[model samples]
Target: QQQQQQQQQAAAGGDGGQMTEFSIALPAACAQYIVGTNMVNIPTLSKFGAALTLLRDNISGDVVFSYKGSPSAVAESRTLLMHGMNMFGVEIRRQQALLQEQLQA
Candidate 1:
């Protein structure tokens, strides 16, 4: 299991779970638009996808993630992936709030 995780980390451009150097191949469109003028359409995207879009602001066309040996590794997470993951949480809260408002109405 540890070996498998090492391989995954390597594939993700991290050296033994540290992302000091690696290649992140995003689509040409994403690369251009990550630093482009067009507004990202977030509503149509999945929460995870939307969060990744949010990372475009923090990352200078460079996305990063970190993993500790913890079972969940929540603390070791970097801003980009954490923000991307937070997108889902935000979406869920928004939906719940909307549902509550509708019920109140």
Candidate 2:
């Protein structure tokens, strides 16, 4: 009976991986911009069996990004998300500088 119960639990995912979560808080301005972007559709996340959620944190008036999955998956997703955000920021800054130069010209 014990062995059968264990098997049943395993089959039902009750004894599966330890679900892990990672959360990041972003400034409201950046968070609003991210909300309109396609950053959530990361293909690598599905490959790692991870999911991401974004919400406005009312108390802090910030944006909260939550990643849930196995520990390793969550870590990898965090790394990817941060890298993407950094690259996007750099590009946006470069474009703004270029536009400013054009305007001054």
Candidate 3:
């Protein structure tokens, strides 16, 4: 009977368990846009995708110019904003790449 119990315990992998799930809250601004109150999906998204989504949602609203501006001026401002967004996208990509490399190591 003791031998049989030992065999059973061995087959059961010695009681080591599965990983646990974790959850975190979203920031106020992001929570407002998120469909659900839960933020479990944030960690699952690719860094670049998350950054792009953030940029898209942020700039979706009207772009307010302080004073009366020419068409060219408004276009210039928009272009600058887009350039900054592109930089953010690049940074996110780099961060993801570094994370992947670390995981492999």
Winning candidate number (lDDT): 2
The most accurate candidate by TM-score is 2
Taking all chains together, each candidate's TM-score versus the true structure is: 0.28, 0.51, 0.37
Tens digits of per-residue lDDT for model 3, 1-105: 977765775577542222222223333333233322233243332222443355446644332222123344444434443444455567668989999999999
Error of 3 at 92 (Å): 0.5
Distance (Å) between predicted and true CA of 79, model 2? 2.2
Summarize candidate 1's per-residue lDDT along 1-105 as a digit string, tens digits.
999987997678666555232224443334333323222333212222533564655555434322333322333233433344455457568889999999999
How badly does each model clash, as a count of residue pairs?
A: 0, 0, 0
**Candidate number that wins on lDDT, 2 or 3:** 2
Query: Which stretches of model 2 miss by more than 4 angstroms?
Result: 1-16, 43-61
Better of 1 and 3 by TM-score: 3
Candidate order, TM-score descending:
2, 3, 1
Give the per-residue lDDT of model 2 (tens digit) for 1-105: 988876776678764335778777666555544443675466544342211233433223655566676566677778876876786688789989999999999
lDDT of all predictions: 0.45, 0.61, 0.42
Name the better of 2 and 3 by TM-score: 2
Evaluate model 2: give its TM-score: 0.51
